[model samples]
Target: MNQIAPIRPDAARNLPQPAALRAGIGAVLDIDLDAIAANRAKLIEVAGGLDCAAVVKADAYGLGAEAVAAALARAGCDKFFVAHIDEGIALRAAVPTASIFVLHGVVPGAEGAMCAYGLIPVLSTPAQIEIWRERAARRGKNLPAALHLDTGMARLGLSEHEFYALANDPSNLAGLDLRLVLSHLAAAEEKDNPSNARQREKFEDLRKRLPKIPASLANSSGVFLGRAYHFDLLRPGAALYGIAPRADEPNPLAQVVKLSARVLRVDDLPAKTPVGYNGRYVTPAPSRIATLSLGYADGFCRALGNSRVNAGFAGQKLPIVGNVSMDMITVDASSLPPGRLREGDFVDVIGGDADSVDRIAQAAGTIGYEILTALGARFQRRHSFSNEGRLA
Candidate 1:
């Protein structure tokens, strides 16, 4: 048998690179991890000597959890929070040394895996506390866990009656090393919502009843409620990933995500021509249109295309024309000079100061977290970091 000779080095050097076959057809979510570190640093500074804990729950708000956690761990973030035990275990695999706090606490049968992975559950109910305490006893030592008390959220955590019962019987906490006592803040973003102080006061009162250990009550928004809410540790989720902590106030966090879509083609329509599904929009005059390779299925909300929200490119606003389809949407590019938009040219769908994630979400009658978490898997993701500041 004769073997083929090896290709010449010069010939191999002339080979074409593998093409990004799908990147040009959808969209790209450019994630700047450096902005995340900056956000953390800002939160730490605002925390006034308190340790900051990064919340990587919801897969780091849909920006890739493992990558986000690893980047944050490198930025001196030793604490991480996840909404589920599975997320905690996965994060444990990513940053082995960091503390992974599972917000949902130990599910009844999951205690074994929880211990095996060295995961800390934020026990919220009496039964959960009892179960964790028994597990600690069975292990013949105290196990690290956090306790969550409900102040006003009325969602998770122990009710006032259950907590008082536990407080009355200190034995309930035995065999467990209580590392943190936290509460959920329902109105941290509303500066004037009297509930912030009410919850803080309630948390303070609850603290007096429990064992003296480090405690936390701050969420991403809570961190901005000032040092009183800071306590021993600050748990910031959305803010670290660039969601504005306060809704009405200016966004203090640096923008971390840039979403861009490539124009697939341009079209011209005569006056009074119908466009898009069901003809929701009709061209009043001769018009120019550019269709982008992104749509509602890609987490670019349908409300954006239908509600007259505009996309941006080189400071020019391309007003969305009609209904957003599953994988495509058309924008009115008639206002721009001819040839301004063409096939393969990228439009800044989520860029510029005006097209910030929060702004777009507001136009869609939602919040930034929804916008961030809704980011679909169709887009190409690029994660980058910088030492001096945000990565370009």
Candidate 2:
């Protein structure tokens, strides 16, 4: 097996250029690291004096976790979160000095690796707590860990009853150095949801019962729920990647990614001409059709194949038509200016340069997160390293 050498932040220029690799691929995912740092700045500004933690889980929501984490770390992010221990471990290698929290906790034998890698598992259940304690005892040291209490979202974390049980017995926390207490929000984005108040109150009440350690209850949206949900730290994930933390509101974060693909072919199809596989679409008139070097296999949702969802070129909306093939998608370019589009011309498909992720998501009947993380690797990635304000 060939081993890939580690690439340092300073050596980023020497790393494989996925962005320029579009020699034949035709598609490019332009990632703006500066925009990400600016997003963190926005988060910090909103956080007041509280520390801001970045959630780089799902490979920084599929924008490449290592690069993103390194950028965040430079921008003063000291803490990070990933859902699984494996994600935590991989991230630990990238940002060695930063604290990495495993939201999913440890998995039996994986306890050794978890502790060895200096990961702080969010001990949410008694089983996880017990295994973590055992790992600490075997190592003859009280290892650091975080406690997750169930405030409202019954997803993970200790229930009210179990929380109180641990509060009553200090011995349950032995061999574990509780560094922070955290909880998740069910709908902090709703803004007016009563659950936000209920969870905030519950978290405040639970903190008094538990050991005196810092507590965090907000995710991306929770930060906007005001200082009450800010707690001692703010954990934001999607917002850092340009995902709107709240629904039906203007996204405050900078657009971090722009996906564009080349026009593979263009031709005029007369009325009644069948398009793509299964004839999902038929020409309504003599329409100029363009085939993009992109499709469902590249994480473009299949449901968006023949839907109202469209692409963009030269400040014009190019409607997608026909079934989205594994490697290509056809778009109606009849609305484009005469000869404005041709073979090899690039068109913005996902974000920034054209339709926002939110708008495109509405067309696909999905959310911005689904679109961002589902982005496949076929497209070469180009990251904006400049510290300029913003492009759009």
Candidate 3:
């Protein structure tokens, strides 16, 4: 067998920089774990010292749950909320000491796995409560869990009749340790929306009926609704990932993600030249078009190409001018002087600005959460951290 020769470090310098290769390599997703930690700390401060739990569901909003949960745990975040039992189980290894709560509770016959993994289920229905209570009784010890009350969202949690039934028949909760009672907010982002107060009042009224357990009624936007919604715990998901907490408001959280696409090729097309599929965009004048190595498949929404969005290189805003392809999109870079943007260069499809995610989401006709979670597996993900203030 022939052995390959090893290139020396000095000789390697002549070749394409792996550093450069990665910078211009397809789609790049740069995630700042430190910024996420900082965002959690900011939420904790905003909650006025209330226990703030990190929501790492949907793979930490598609940023990688293991890394995000570990970073939060190191930052002194002891409580974490995931949307599913499997998510909590997967995150168990990353934050062994943190309290992992499963927001969707457990399916029937899966109670053993929840306990085996030490995950607390958020019982949202009478059926789920009965299952947990039976499991606790079988185990001959109290199993910790959270009770979710339906405080106007009407999506999850026990209904008003069920809630009162449980309140009247406290025996239904026997053998289970109800650590927390929580509810979801529907329009916490709409500060002036009357529903917020109604939900708060409903949650308050419901909590009074149950045992005086610590309660949580605030989500990311709820944290901004002042101390009344703060309650005993705050579960913030989107805000931690740098999504704007409210519509039309400045995002105070540090930007945590920067997505860039590599320039694959550049073309010079004359006036009246049609571009992309179906000629959705036609060049009104001679144009300099740079093809990027990302599209709808890479989480760059196709609607963006139709909505007059701009990708950035240096300080120049390059308008996307064509239908988005599965693996490419063309941007008109004519505004920049010739040779400024080369085939190997990269441009910001989603930049580091706080509003970049929301802005692009609006253009794509979706919310930021969808934008983040839709990020495909094709991109190279880079997680970084910095020594900033402590999250505790």
lDDT winner between 1 and 2, please give it: 2
For all candidates, the clash counts are: 0, 0, 0
- Per-residue lDDT of model 3, residues 1-392, tens digit only: 11112222223111111232354469888877777878887888787767789999999998989877777766668899999999999989888878999999978979989999999999998889889988988999999999998988879999888989888977878988888999999998899999999999998998998647999999999999999999899999999998989868888877888888889999888999999999999999999999999988887788888436778887888888899999999999998898899988878888642128888888877888999999999988776654342243
Task: In angstroms, give how far residue 88 of model 2 lies from its true place.
Answer: 1.5
For model 3, the superposed segments whose C-alpha errors exceed 4 Å read 1-25, 353-355, 386-392
lDDT of 1 at 61: 94
The full ranking of all candidates by lDDT, starting with the best, is: 3, 2, 1
Residue-wise C-alpha lDDT for candidate 1, range 1-392, written one tens digit per residue: 11112222123222122224364457877777767877887888777757999999998998888877877776678999999999988878778888999999997899999999999999999889989988998999999999999998899999888989888987878988888999989988898899999999999988888748788999999998888988999999989878888778898887888888889999888988888898888888999988889998998888887536778777778888889999988888888888877889878788551288888888889998999999899888776553333322
Worst 10 contiguous positions by lDDT, candidate 3? 8-17
Model 2 agreement with the true structure over 1-392: per-residue lDDT tens digits? 11112223365322223344446776889887877877777777777757989999998988888888887777678899998988988888678888999999877989888877999999899899999898889899999999999998888999999988877998988999988999999988899999999999998989997647998988888888898889888999988888888768888887888899889889988999999999989998999999999988899878887746768887788888898898899999999866889998899888754678777777778888889889898888776565542333
Error of 2 at 235 (Å): 0.5
With a 3 Å backbone cut-off (N, CA, C), the pairs that clash in candidate 3 are: none
Better model by TM-score: candidate 1 vs candidate 2:
2
